[model samples]
Target: MSWIKTRLKSFGYAFNGLWTLFRTETHAQIHLLALVVVTVAGLITGLERWEWLAIILTIALVVAAEGMNTALEALSDALHPGHHPLVGKAKDVAAGAVLFCAIAALAVALIVFLPHWL
Candidate 1:
């Protein structure tokens, strides 16, 4: 029972963190909108099971990367509290990670949907 309770509490905290990201982050909101659009497109095109799986995984990867970037930025800011070259570099690297994931996801989307569109 105690173990189960601990796991549940961890889940609760995870959900709360997700809520914080969506509530406070503009990038998260944009990603969510893009997710909705992609889901709608996938449904409308009748994506195959494997295609659906790929799309879902790609979306999750991008969002997770964005979340990680946000977390890093927050931590960097909290630790430095002011301009610091190292902190700036850390934040830039985090943002770049998000960008890399977004680009990969976009490429996957194009590969998956271009045929349907054409």
Candidate 2:
């Protein structure tokens, strides 16, 4: 394949994975809901450009973390179909990474939105 075609094909694969994530993962669906809410709130509040940038970046971070966690969990489960303590621990660690990103996203939301509300 030509370089451009290969790049486009890769994008297609990435989008397919994202579709699977949203379709099969409840957590990803929740994140999508949160994204819609945050977007509406941002529009309603007339967030400044910098505030929008922060919100956008935070949302991306959280979503990326969740995606990574999902990938890790799926890989672990596939590799070790039987219950394993180490696999459980790896999955837990991946989940914790997602949690930390979520908390940071919350902090960013508060910093960017609290003043506007108050």
Candidate 3:
């Protein structure tokens, strides 16, 4: 019972984090909108199991990367509070990571959908 309670508490904390991200991050809202659009497209196109798996993985990867970028930006802002060269570099790197993930996800979506579209 204690172990189950601990796992549930962990899930609650994760949910709280996700809620905070969506509530506070404009980029998260955009990602969520993209997610909805992708999901609808996948359904309408009748994606195969493998295509669905790829799309799901890509979505998860992009979202996770964005979450990490957000966390890093927040921490960097708090620690520096002003424009410091190292902090700026770190923030840029974090943003770049999100961009890379977004681009990769876009590529995956195109590959998965092109056949259905054509």
Candidate 4:
């Protein structure tokens, strides 16, 4: 119980970072909106058991990656506090990771949902 409490306390910073990301990040908002739509469509379309698992897993992975990326960018900016090419490139790379996850999620959706729609 004590260990768990200490672990949770350490997560306060992460939670704060996540809240900041949700409030300030436009792309994060967009991803969340898409997550809602995809979840609704999957449920309404009666996806197969495996499809449900894939859809849920993909959403989790993408969102988790986005959150981590947001944290990384924020930390980097705080540390650098000035315009540096390396910092800029690092941020861009983090953003690109989110984009890759979004694209992969789209592919997963097409694979799982296309037969029904087509």
The global C-alpha lDDT for each of the candidates, from Candidate 1 onward, is 0.94, 0.94, 0.93, 0.89
**Candidate 2 stretches greater than 4 Å from native:** none
What's model 2's lDDT at 78? 89
- Cα lDDT, model 3, residue 62: 88
Give the Å shift of residue 73 in candidate 3: 1.1
Better of 1 and 3 by TM-score: 1
Q: Model 3 Cα displacement at 42 (Å)? A: 0.4
Clashing pairs in 3: none
Candidate 4 residue runs with Cα over 4 Å from true position: 7-17
Separately for all candidates shown, the number of backbone clashes (residues 3 or more apart, or on different chains) is 0, 0, 0, 0
Over 3-98, each residue of candidate 4 has an lDDT whose tens digit, in order, gives 999999889977887787778988788878888999899888999899999999999888888987888887998999899999999898988988
Regions more than 4 Å wrong, model 3: none
Residue 71, candidate 2: C-alpha displacement in angstroms: 0.4
lDDT by residue for model 2 over 64-112, one digit each (tens)?
9989999999999889999999999999999999999988988999999
lDDT of 3 by residue, 52-98 (tens): 99999999998999899999989888888999999989889988999
lDDT of candidate 1 over 18-98, digit per residue (tens): 999999999999999999999999999999999999999999999899999999988887889999998899889989989
RMSD of each: 0.7, 0.9, 0.9, 2.0
Return the TM-score for each candidate structure: 0.97, 0.96, 0.95, 0.85
